[model samples]
Target: MIDFTKRQKEIMTILSKHEPITAEQIAEMLGVSKGTLRSDLAVLVMTGQIEAKPKVGYYLSKNMQKQKQQDIWNQTFVKDIQGVAITVKGTTTVNDAVISLFLEDVGTLIVVNEHNELEGIVSRKDLLKVTLGNAQATSMPVQLVMTKQPKIYTIEAEKTVFEAAQMMVYYEVDSLPVVKPVENSQALKVIGRITKTNIVKALIEMGSEA
Candidate 1:
């Protein structure tokens, strides 16, 4: 099951009690910047925990009630977070990574070595900086262009989805790599990736239609 952070829980509680509220109101109540509140709101909305109305503010979606009944959050696990996981060899060129990103329609790519062990992670932002002025993408190795030893987040297959959600909220990350324990950090194996998009989809599937 996914986990919810204290802040996320508090925010959800606030929305539960006073939804259809403005981002300004949330910011004031939470003593956070509007930008931070907006980020939280984006995650919430993406997870189907809240809904936004143009010029009307945000509200707790009707799905909340159904979520309670089905225990939707409790049913989520690492396996539920599966998606297309494209891997690139560390020796691959930066240009190849860019092409993969476009072709795969993915923002991030997991870089692996010859042994299929994760070496690093590359995101659009990482590539943009180098591509901004450079003409050669093929010359740059992915290892030199990727975010090495990134802060890794994981959840066990048997854990509750709420726990996973909480971790994401606490870390302010869009996704978490579900992994199986290995002898060392370099040995970890990615089983799946839990993302905000998947969480929202799960909520919609379990929540009320309206």
Candidate 2:
């Protein structure tokens, strides 16, 4: 099943009880302005959670809802939504890493060793925590604040996106490093990354096809 945000879930509940509800009604009941929910409504429609008619408003998509569950089960593999991975070296300084983070526009950066082997992960939170009390954050190595190996959560390419989504929800992470086992070696090589946005896009694409 597709993961629904708290507000989305509430909206769905409202629709279930009142079919063909107006967007203005949903927004009013949810205590948010109608304008702010445009994307949410679009996503709901695009993901096949709801059907919309310009004059008729929105209602739960009965037919697509049934197919959605099965689609989630059948579309197995993280590779389906994987995107090119972005990485930083363990030696990268906080200043440089911050610049890279903005330049790349990514939430997390995979840290690698000299051999391009996975070392750890540095997230925006990690950078913020270290920078809060330290004036020398610019010179400090990312390795100093990065979440180290054994603590990082990773997914193999073969794993289902459902499994990856579950991991994200459970771990409260925005993204996951996609890795693959190196033959005859104990190390895993980072190949790609999957984010919540990727999952949403995949769902919308599938819904469109459906």
lDDT of 1: 0.74
Q: What TM-score fits each model?
A: 0.61, 0.67
Stretches of candidate 2 exceeding 4 Å from the true structure: 1-64
lDDT of 2 by residue, 1-210 (tens): 778789998888788667678999999999999998888898898887899988998988987466555667457579988998889999999999999999999999999877677889998888988998888887999999999988999999888888998999999999999998878987779989999899888878766554
Report the number of the highest-TM-score candidate.
Answer: 2
Clashes of 1: 16
lDDT per residue for candidate 1 within 45-105, as digits (tens), equals 8888888898988887788755654465776665765564577988888888889999987
Clashing pairs in 2: none
